[model samples]
Target: MKVWKSVVSAALVSVLLAGCGSNAGTDNEQNEVKAGSTVNLKVFVAQPRLKEHYDKYIEQFKAKEKADKNIEVNVQLEMPPADNAPQILKTRLASNDAPDVFALHAVNEIPPFSKAGYLEDLSNQPFVDKLLDSVKPSVTDASGKVVAVPLETLSWGYLYNKDIFKEQGLEVPTTLTEMKAVVEKLKAAGITPFELSYKEAWVPQLFLPLTVGALTQTEHKDFVEKMNKDEASFSDMKALFDVFDLVNANGTDKALEVGADDGAAAYATGKAAMWIQGPWYAETILKSNPDVNFGVAPMPLNDNPDDTKINLSTSTSLAVSSSSKNKEVALDFVNYILDDKDSSAFYEALKFNPVAKVHTFKSFPWVDDALKYVNEGKAYQDPKIPQAVKDESGKALQGYYSGQLNQQQVIDALDKAWKSYNKVNK
Candidate 1:
């Protein structure tokens, strides 16, 4: 889901007001508006790819609010790039100018914000009652408080072109050895085996965290704990490098230079037979080539078929600001979006899988397949590693892919980085 990076400017904030609506009254007046008066609630979101869906929901929610509570809901939408959103939101909250409502990652991203008391606790909110049982644990904190409403439960895996697989008589590989044979066949047939976009450091870093899940299942369930205690090191986890070698060997020669959009284009145009990504990229790929047929499977990280599993977690969630002047209205808006009727429309508009208990909605085949693993608890969430460690690990992987460092050197660097980060953060 780490797609783009762009600075959020003051000018962009000004533009968002025009996009939503004109400011009808003073900030204080708007905040203290009576039931019958028009009130504006600022909503900060990061998914630019789903802008149309958000726009539609804003209009729908406004109409519903006016009808139910006689208050005109003006939704000012501010969308920074996904990669820049977390820092921007943190800064805004710290400055006491937090958005009335905002989108955030459910796992690693939410803890610090919740600890700092920036998010409103929604544990007893009606929307929390509607969340699917499978998704409930993600939105709840360690203290069993529901801090955010689950938006989308996403899965990451290898996306393959069904048409190419069918035409070439290639079966979906469930093991690393099988995957290598498939890659060889694809390459022999003059098809790029994988679409790798390493220029976006976040993209390459994804596999590392995902591999942690597979490793936990097969080798060490307490790997993260041991690492934190300085009893374990990345050098001890050599299976990850083996998986990297397979991917790097089959990827496009210019992968290190390819950005996200370029990688999507290559895969959608049938230049590559597969791409490792999450369900978030499905819309973009389909938009690029409507005729392209694809399906998703867990990343085959090891030779044992049982060792591979999809990476699944709540990729995004919605929360109201604890300090919002219009907390009631903001909470109401959150409730409406998480409601079954409105939430279904929101997911349908964006073509995203629902995290709510909406049993009638049918997911894309790829998403449905990934959900099987999720239902069985075979999916993994990224460990709550520090952002600095994630950044360092990504750089190390880039070095490995670029032939600037050997596998052992990369592991040593990651272990060193982790120990240093732990000491500083502690």
Candidate 2:
């Protein structure tokens, strides 16, 4: 999910031929020529790791579009690098000449683009009917403009080696104290109970939510929407540092000694008993050994043992360019991939939870419980601050991860970033 490939932040654009995509003779003739000799459909994505899925989808799309006598589809794919996608997409969108379809890393990216009239409004579009009610909000603008289609969702949680649990005769901690005790117990057994990497810098900062979820008992499931209204403040982010204190108390920085990739590797090899990661950890850890028995659970609420709530509340989204001369065709292509029925196979291949009518929690049992929880009126989207705030947060966390700042300093920096970033747009 976070590892999706090359995009700048939401600032992206793509020039279209006069008739880049339209029927040879149709009322929407403006879009009729996208495929003159060949209709070129350029797309941007975040998950390059999921290329196989896109390649297959493209092949199918090409076949279907070519079957039509009037239009042809050419698929050009690109993704943003691992870090700073929000930054990259922002740059591209500002450049004016960008891609036809691109991924929106978060709902926040869509607003500025929507304000700029850069994304197509699909609220009343046919594809809007096919998405799950739960997924639609992530793509809609404040004006309720549907700038993108909901693809799949990514949830966050703590993943532990079930085998390790059994070996230690430890039950999954349901209470806050027990959770920390579990960490302590594992450490006493000469095991690092958690995995963390400061090199990527954002790693530990990202995990702060696990603690926040535990602390609030998941009361702030709408943290994003609330933050959007200027009601929330990152300056009050002492909650975040409290979460990191667990990592510090446990002296788990040994894992931080490694890079993000290697820290996950350590977990895969059984050197670490627990990990705070999202579903992507499945693929990352599996690379070493798919057989590693891991169990997924919501991050402890307020560290509450029995509180089994907190939504892994966000997803990367897919959207069409407003400049597309082939509006109808582009919409059709996006709908073909994201609509309920088609999205089942699409979600399976992409390994994300389906947010479309076609997806079932059962289809992704690994992530099902989390998605089910989200659909059942739980989960919260990540706070989508302005580009400035986001980069500031990332940089601040990077500093935290690298031990460049002490705990209080980390919180202060986030407060500064959030305020400064929000100030510009305000």
Candidate 3:
């Protein structure tokens, strides 16, 4: 049988294969390999939600390796929550015990690692040609090399319960004024217009990206550049604060106490009409309430309908370790996952929109709608801002949500953080 077919078959029989006791070792024992032995490659993946799918793909990868190379391959799969993986991976890399392969965010996450000489350059790989041109910028490094295989493109917006909107006789809002009016109507009907989970600092900050994209579409195309150069401040973007105020004023009571999981559950159970998030929460929401019909749309940012645009970019990419003992095997495995015949299955398993040109995604109406922006080049991805600035921005947004910092204070804090970060990083 061909490798791809064998991989598909292995996926089917993965449960039985799970008991085979693959001899993959941990980072502590990675260097203790016997002479003339099977290859072992450790793969660190951050998507805890897709552990099963990754495990199945790894099994398929192993089966294919044995068939094609006549050498047994043991893949040690390390699964971690998205929130904690980067720090752990960083520690491991700094200690010279990096995994053979790992998943990382394309932009802000790649630079430090790549500059530190921890990532292998995959620019000339065949898989690089398969990626959607639109996503190439995010995965490309300062050296003009594609350092990773982009696995999925993600878009953030408002996930609204279509059923609730239809029953309430409300059209999906396309402008900020319309959105505020809809919120009032929903509130009048005793429904929470927006679900805010400010306890999870990142949740409240979701509004920023959509707001940023809308600003870029209207008047701030050089926003990221100016911010990086210290020539502009978040205060310059008053529209973002206006949108933040609209969302905070319309959120559920006790929203400051809600976490991401609780907020998702609330939206899933019809406790709220809207939740600002990306496609990452779709599975969780569907699992919570399979019958609830939902769709995603750009966050309406102003009175002009055309000003709204989705924030789209390569959300995850796979990269090989520069210091790996098994670089050849790692490269092969990365290529296998992205090959035309296998890429769709890998993406489908994660329920993510594919970044490869070989696949087509039509699963969700909101995803389809987001694709229209992508095709028309109406989407936006923030440039490579310093990690310190990114982290501080989240805190600033949370403070705004809690009224602990006024609008100007939040902007000042971010501007200060950005300047300080540039001094050190530059």
Which candidate number would show the highest lDDT if scored against the true structure?
A: 1
Question: Which candidate has the highest TM-score of all?
Answer: 1
Per model, how many backbone clashes are there?
0, 45, 0
Q: TM-score for all predictions?
A: 0.85, 0.80, 0.84
The 10-residue segment with the lowest total lDDT in model 3: 1-10
Q: Candidate 3 — which residues are off by over 4 angstroms?
A: 1-36, 360-363, 374-378
Task: Kindly list the per-residue Cα lDDT of model 1 for residues 403-425, writing each as its tens digit.
Answer: 77788777776677667645533
Candidate numbers sorted by TM-score from highest down:
1, 3, 2
Model 2, stretches more than 4 Å misplaced? 1-29, 34-36, 208-235, 248-265, 301-308, 325-329, 339-342, 371-387
Q: Residues 53-107, candidate 2: write the lDDT tens digits.
A: 7888878777766675446677788865445565565555554444677887544
lDDT of 3 by residue, 231-342 (tens): 8887767787778788888878777677777787888999889888777777777778878888877887778877777777676788987778887788888988786777
Q: Which stretches of candidate 1 lie over 4 Å from their true place?
A: 1-33, 372-378, 403-409, 416-426
List per-prediction Cα lDDT, in the order shown: 0.74, 0.62, 0.72
